[model samples]
Every structure is written in structure tokens, then in C-alpha cells.
Target: MTHSEMITVLSQRLRWPEEKVSELLSVATEVIGDQLSEPGTLSLPGLGNFTSRKSKEFISLHPETGERYLIPPSIDLFFRVAPALKKQFEEREEE
Candidate 1:
């Protein structure tokens, strides 16, 4: 859902003001970003695991032009779904 839609849903469910939910989401986003930048992992139960890994530099070749390029190493973020969440999707698909 969109940010506003999420805020509305969370506000209604938690009985909190939209402004408060917005701020909470903003803070959570910032915290997640900061943790990922440290090349760390964050695991939330029933959700998934978030991780950051550094990729090694590599060389790439252009098939058509026969040109070679150097690719710089970078940090990549990944998410692995929790088993329970995956199972829920599988059951939904079977229905």
C-alpha cells in the first residue's frame, strides 16, 4: 500500500493519530536504513530477514562491441521471507 494508506490503516488499528503513525514509520525506515548501511542483518519474526552483503568487483564484456568494462564492488541489500509467511502465501495460492 501507499504511505498514506498504510498510515491510515495503522492509525485506525492502533488508535493513534495519523501524524504519530507517520513519524513512527519514518523513524523505523531511518533505523532500518542505518542498520543496513553497517552491513548488518535485521530479523523480524513472522516477516523476514533483511541483510546487506558486499559484492566483489568483476569485469564485464560487451558481446556486440567486444568491449571490456570494470564493475566496481558494491553493497547489496536482500530479503529472505520467513517460513511462516511463505507458507501462508502457498496456502492462499492453493485456494
Candidate 2:
């Protein structure tokens, strides 16, 4: 879902005003971004993690032109679903 949708849902479910929820969400996002920008890992129990790692610069192929261009090394966001979330998906498969 979009960020705004999340904020709306959270506001309703938590009984908080939309503005308050939005502010909290903004702060949470900014703090997470700042932490990630600093080159580290953020682990949230049963909620996966956000981490930064080094990668080599390489050429990337253009989908339309088939031409390659340089892709500089950069911080990438990697998300691995927590085991609990994985279990939820596996159960859905059974259904």
C-alpha cells in the first residue's frame, strides 16, 4: 500500500488523528533513513531488517536499446521477510 494509505489506516486503528499519525510516520521514516544512510543494519524483531553494503560499480544493459552504461556503486536497500511473515505466506499457499 502507499504511504498515505498506511497512515490513514494506522490513524483509524490506533484512534489517533491523521495529522498525528502522519507526523509519527514521517519521523519514523526519517530516522530509519538517517540510520541507513550511516552504513549499518537495523534489526526489528519479527519484522526483518534494513542494511547497507558495498557493491562494485558495473555496466548495466538498457532494456530498450540493449546498450550498456556505467552503474556506480551505491547503497542498496535489501529487505528479507522475517520468518513469521514467511510462515504466513506459506500458510496461504496451503489454502
Candidate 3:
């Protein structure tokens, strides 16, 4: 779900005001972003991991023209689902 949708759900489930939920969400996201910017991994228990990786410069091909080009190095973010979380989802799917 989208951020607004998530906030709405949390507001209803926790009986919290939307404004409060929004503020908490904002703070949480900001903290996560800060940690990732530090080039570190942020792990959430029973959830997943958030990490960043720096990719080396590489050559690329234009799909339309098949022309070759150089792609600059960049940092990329990734997420890996926790095993417990994955198991819970798999169990739900089986049901």
C-alpha cells in the first residue's frame, strides 16, 4: 500500500490520530534514510534488512538503437525479507 494508505490503516488499527501516525512515520523514515546514507545496514527484527551498495561503472546498450554507452557508478538500495517474515507469508499463501 501507499504511504497514505499505510497511515490510514495504522490509524485505524492502533486507534491513533492520522497526524500522530504521520509524524511517527516521517520520523521513522528519516531515521532509516539517515542510517542508509551512512552506508550501513538497518535491520528490523522479524521484518527485513535495508542496505545500500555501490555499483561500479559499466557499459550499457541502448535497447532501441543497440548503441553502447557508459553508465556511471551509483549507489543502490536493497531489501531482504527476514526468514520469519517470509515464512509467515508463505503460510498465509498456503491457507
Candidate 4:
């Protein structure tokens, strides 16, 4: 969902002012980003872990021209869903 929608949901759920929720959301996002800049994993028990690592540079084939091009490497962010959360989605899909 978009940031505004998230703020609205949090405000309603927490009974907090929209402005306060917005500020908290902004701070939380900035903190998460700052933490990820270093090499480490940030874990939220019921959600998942967030981590980053350098990706290997690779060559890509241009479909239109059949020409090969080099794709530069960059930091890759990863999130592995918690087992419980994955199971919930899987069970729902079975219905």
C-alpha cells in the first residue's frame, strides 16, 4: 500500500493522530534504511528478516538487437518470510 494509506490504517488501528503516525512511519523507514547500510540482518520476529548483499555483475542480451550488454552489480535487499506467515498464505491458497 501507499504511504498515505499505511498512515491512515495505523492511525485508525492505534488511535493516534495521522500526523504523529506519519512522523513515526518516516522515522521508522529512515532507521531501517540506516541499519541496512551496514552488513547485518534486521529481524522482526513475526514478519521476516531484512538484509543486503552485493550482487554479481552479469551480461544481459538485448532482445531487439541481439546485442550483449554488461549489467553493473548493485546491493540486493532480501526478505525471507517467517515460516508461520508463509504457512498462513499457503493454507489460504488451498481453499
Compared with the true structure, all predictions reach lDDT values of: 0.92, 0.85, 0.90, 0.88
Global fold similarity of model 2 (TM-score): 0.72
Kindly list the per-residue Cα lDDT of model 4 for residues 1-95, writing each as its tens digit.
Answer: 98799889999999999999999888989999988877678898889999888788999998999999999987778998998888888788542
Return the TM-score for each candidate structure: 0.81, 0.72, 0.72, 0.72
Model 2 C-alpha lDDT per residue in residues 1-95, reported as the tens digit of each score? 99899988999999999999999888988988888876678887788887876677999998999999999988877877789878877788542
Winner of 1 and 4 under TM-score:
1
In angstroms, how far off is 10's CA in candidate 1?
Answer: 0.5
Cα lDDT of model 1 by residue, 1-95, tens digit? 98799899999999999999999899999988888887778999999999999888999999999999999998899999999999998888542
TM-score of 4: 0.72
Identify the leading candidate in terms of TM-score.
1
Colliding residue pairs in candidate 2: none
Error of 3 at 27 (Å): 1.8
**Which regions of candidate 3 deviate over 4 angstroms?**
56-73, 93-95
Clash totals for all candidate models: 0, 0, 0, 0
- Candidate achieving the largest lDDT: 1
Which of 2 and 4 is the better model by lDDT? Answer: 4
